[model samples]
Target: MAISSYDISSANTELARRAGYVDAQWALPAINAVELRRLQRRSNLHATLSTSLWLGLTVIAGFAVVATAWSWWSIPSVAVYAALYGGASDSRWHEMGHGTAFRSRRANDVIYYLACFMLLRGPTIWRWSHYRHHTDTIIKGHDAEIAFQRPPSVARTLWRFTHLQGGSELLLRLVRHAGGRLDDEAKELVPAHERRRVVLESRIMIGVLLIAVIATVVLRSAIPVVLIGGSTFLGGWLVVFFGITQHAGLQENVFDHRLNTRTVMMNPVFRFLYLNMNFHVEHHMFPSVPYYSLPSLHGEISSQLAPALPSTWAAYRQIIGAFRRQQVDPNYEIPLELPKIEGDARPVEIGAESWMRGPSGEVIVGLETSFGLGELRKVDIGRHSVVVGRTESGSLFACEGWCTHAKVHLGEGAVIGEEIECPKHNARFDCRTGEATRKPAKDGLTTYPVTVSKGRVSVHLVGIDSVGS
Candidate 1:
């Protein structure tokens, strides 16, 4: 198949669809239950400490700049201040946006909104945009956030260091959004119900900057504006410095992250600022795994992935070479060296088993005796892949197999109490009602009425509303 042209217009088109680039299922390395449980655990204390340190550093840096505003020392001070306020906020925004940084959902929201304003991104708009980013990943014309599109623009990449072209464009978009005007892509990516919130956030962000501007005017000094609204431009270099390493020079329209995403080792300070996102490949593979747990996740899956660059410099060396090649040959991609692992070469098992009919017109999923308590199984009924699981009480429950958030098979996920957590992003849904109970999974699953009789488990093929009736 011909490669996709790689633009938003190509999304869901025949070319992209024929290439298996639209809504494509991806494979995951085999992991045991115990290892998954350990990686998925969330801790409030760990998130609290990380957030606290970030906030503490910003405060210290802000005070340092204020104390020496007119001195030569202030130049370095402001750089540190801007890095904390603008650069580091990018990572904080990303982590909190995933809602994986904190055990408490409210805590994640608090930091997410703050970082959104600091980075000048509309929270609602960005949240949905990021959801799409994960779903399509590096697929051209589908992923909204593909940095350094093929035929890499050297001038534009260099301009981003000053946040001039990119930052200005974002500010202009915010201004338009503040007036309740959304661009076509924004309207398409953001749900209608969410557009209002996106507008509201835009207004709030603009209002905050207006306040800072007014403060600067009244005080007859640029200090207020410099510290608040102007930092994004001065300190945005850090964002570009770290962000470019992630999929910058990698292939697009590929289903696997190992071929398209990169992982670079960084010093402790850079990791702290970037919130361990240097492990970009691992993060993309398991977005639900918290930032603190990424190192362990890397340790588990590193062998299956292309060898990670030992340092940021090493990664940049590769990236620069790819950029040079892609400038002339757009199809050039850095080959990934993956280690051989048993059964790693097979395609993902999806829609693997067909369902049979029961005695009373019920869809027979499987023999109840074969499905153990607390075990999840995937059953294909017609075109649908349904996840059927037995609770600890031996009660059968069934929901759509694919996660509402990213379309990953739910049978591969963990079952907690009455909820099934999506393995890709940890979004959870109530098994009985099919109501989404977590972030990123705003939509719920399609549930089916399940029954066990005469040693067989079957699902009612009626609509969701008639389930369990």
Candidate 2:
């Protein structure tokens, strides 16, 4: 059936009401221009320094472990050191994976590859899957980051398997998934090129494993490998445990922003161990923000987000209780509906048209048919208030009708240099490149390309391919 415009509006309104929000207040926790710029600068500094410290500690710990390995008594001590090093290195690697640890893309790539090599994981595969997770968090059937679903009978069987081996079962699952023979349905989640790259990297990781095995044989001592390897295993498991605790039992509601994810405010120890991942909801809201800056970003807008989720400990307790009751009920489902916004008669542009504007007298840039929304099966067009402005150098930039990070419009944000700052969360995005310049936003703003011909400015309704392209 051909869908009518009225059906779209009615669906949107119903969705908004179910989400417990008013259309007028859809834009939230407004902030002024100056604060946004300040926050961006602070986030940049924190990300850089934190990443460096973690890397330096990892190197030092590795040397210490090797030096202590001379004595049999030091085997367990070396194990402890190896675990600490692995965990700490993984923290820095996580930041690099997000492209927030280093300003240079090449440097981030180097760190990411090295970290993945040590962890026996695939960097390209991790990036493809993680990027998708950020774009479609809590989106069931589409998001692969969520654990695989199982029927009640299968769940019971899996529980029995886990009970038999305890930690070994978890390790077996990782091996099976990373064995480079993913099923057709599982393969679709990753880009084809990335899947190939992952298979290649997995081969390289196998080489590393072989070298470790050879070393054990040469030394005529399986004890060192067992001790050191056990530590590495424990460290990797801790990282996985942190992820499980963060999202397990959280509602997977694609359209309902409030119930979709959990929020955690961590103590300093947990923050250090998990690398500030405790702020999962804030991270979800702003994926581009570096991990180091998440805690500060969360603090700035805590009041605005408090209504959606409870304290971190509350979430932890809830998950524990659920686990005890069912032993293996991984599905925490919630109904979702898109929110609504009430405003003046303003044209809203999507994807590329978002970047263009008409001549001085005409604010609208493109006709309705310009945007390629044929593939979007369900869409709603309402009065959207967008912040459109030109920089001092005459470059035009368009952001969300509201800041996805803090629900404030870009109109209230200030343009500094080449970036626009989000007042409420101190988030910032490069106007020229449309890349996020600060934490909390993993994905950038949907940017549109602008063009001018014979004094008439036109915004393209296509996606931006690059900064200038």
Candidate 3:
């Protein structure tokens, strides 16, 4: 396959997909059942408390800015308000968008939509864009979220601190989307079925900003604007500050996130504000795990990965040094000190027509003892791959072996309760009915009937139905 030239801007080129950049092969470190369960556990109380605290602080900061207007106190007050609005919202946007932060889907949607408006992004537009980002992280000509391209520009990097370029581009795109004019890049990312929804969301957000503008005009004060949208620009500096540490001077077009992504050890306060996103490499590798569990996940896999930066200052120094060297030699890349991963095992490949078929045409997977309770296994029957899972309660189910959304083998993914999560994009499906229960996976898997008779597990090839039918 011919690899495409690196271009950070265009998404419709189709070169990345043709060259096999999209959904390219990646390595997975071996993990045991206990650690996987702990990492995948989502606590409603923890999520609610964390979200409530952030919201309460934002409300207080907004009120402080209003009360301290036209005074020296306003300077710090505005800064706080902006950090809450722009900086903290970035993390909220990310966590909530993943739907892993909150156990309740409604809660995640509520915060996700709110953060979308606050960040001046179209909800549907950004959702799909983010999906692509995870599917092709740091893959040149495919990953839309690449922060810094090759041949880094010093002046542009400095200007990003103000977020003027990013903010202006966001606003311009918002206006165009609101007017029902989708750009080529956006058209490629956002599905046609979601275009109308994007336009509607953009219009609604624009209308809200207009209301803030009207209030500012009526009251002859910038308070309403500051409270509404101006804070994003003022507070957006911290977003850039922390975001640059992620992949600024790292290698691109690589399948491994350890080389393309960075994990920085941030202060407690910064961790709180960024919602543990400082463990970015772990988050990308195991996206099924929620933000609250990222630290544990990092600890579990950190030995096989590179050592995290000691501090934000240390990360900046490295990034700056790399940027300087890149100015002279565009090929310069920061060498990562990663430990060797040991005993790494790949997924088991099943051949077509490998399993035995009974007289009734039912595929005989194995003995009842083959499937452990709450374990997922892959089986092949006459060129078809099937996923057979047993719940802790001893219920057996069979379905399509691969994730409907990404075609990734579900056998390698984690099983929580009766749901199996896709390892590639974290999309989930209910094992019993093969129903898609998560985003980035709208289509459900095809379920097959499984029966255990005489201590043998048998799967019926007939009567396969897609999820929700």
Task: Please provide, for model 2 over 139-214, each residue's C-alpha lDDT reduced to its tens digit, 9 standing for 90 to 100.
Answer: 4444546652221243543453232343353334335555767444336445564566656666666566566678
The segments of candidate 1 whose C-alpha lies over 4 angstroms from its true place after superposition are: 1-7, 10-15, 345-400, 414-419, 446-469
* Candidate 2 Cα outliers beyond 4 Å, as residue runs: 1-45, 70-76, 147-186, 221-231, 307-315, 326-469
Query: lDDT tens string, model 3, 1-469?
Result: 4444455445424777666777877766556655665577667899999999999999999889989997999999999989999889999999888878887778988999998877887888788878888888888777778878778898888898898888889988889989989887788787677789888888999999999999999999999999898887888888888899999899876777889899999999999999999999988877878999999988888887889999999999999999999999988898886665565424322222236767777778788886766667777554567778776677888888888887688876667667877866778888888899976788998988989889888888776432210
TM-score for each model = 0.84, 0.60, 0.90
**Model 1 lDDT vs. the true structure?**
0.81
Would you list the C-alpha lDDT of every candidate in the order shown? 0.81, 0.50, 0.81
Q: Pull out the clashing pairs in model 3.
A: none
After TM-score superposition, what is the CA distance of residue 297 in candidate 1 from its true location, in Å? 1.0
Relative to the true structure, candidate 3 has a C-alpha RMSD (angstroms) of: 3.9
Best by TM-score: 3
Candidate with better TM-score, 2 vs 3:
3
Q: Residue 121 lDDT in model 1?
A: 86
Clashes of each: 2, 12, 0
Give the 10-residue window scoring lowest on summed lDDT in candidate 1.
Answer: 345-354
